[model samples]
Target: MKAFNDFADRVRKEKREHYSKPVSYCLNYILVYIYEPITLNQLANMVNLHPNYLSTLFKKEIGVSFSEYVQKAKKLMKRNNS
Candidate 1:
């Protein structure tokens, strides 16, 4: 039973890590293309998720809406550039 519980815990952790992949990808893409225009739909398509779902997941993971995060990223880029 202990081994079974350990396996289950590991599985849950893996699933969480898997779910974070799309969010991470979006963050990296936004940072890499900070000057270019980006849309939720484009990112959703790139990540193979529905736009709405991605938006919800992104907000849940990052504590901000998709557009807000993008705007923040752009601002950060500008600050760093200067």
Candidate 2:
């Protein structure tokens, strides 16, 4: 059981690292196009992902919901006058 648990942990870590690129791309896109309207479905299409899969992967990799992350980024941009 202990060995199985360790393997599971390792797999989850690897999955997170593997998913980082798509998450990073989404983050950068949101920042660069912060002023433009965007939706999860639209982002999913842009990233060649299914909306549900992207939503789960994004929350797992980013530690927040997509909308929450976008809102926080927009707030920071506004404060910085960007």
Best by lDDT: 1
| Residue 25 miss distance in model 2 (angstroms) | 1.4
Cα lDDT of all candidates, in order?
0.90, 0.88
Question: Which residue pairs show collisions in model 2?
Answer: none
lDDT per residue, candidate 1, 16-78, as tens digits? 666488999998898888889999999999999999999999998777999998888888878
Q: Candidate 1: where is the Cα deviation over 4 Å?
A: 1-19
TM-scores, one per candidate: 0.74, 0.72
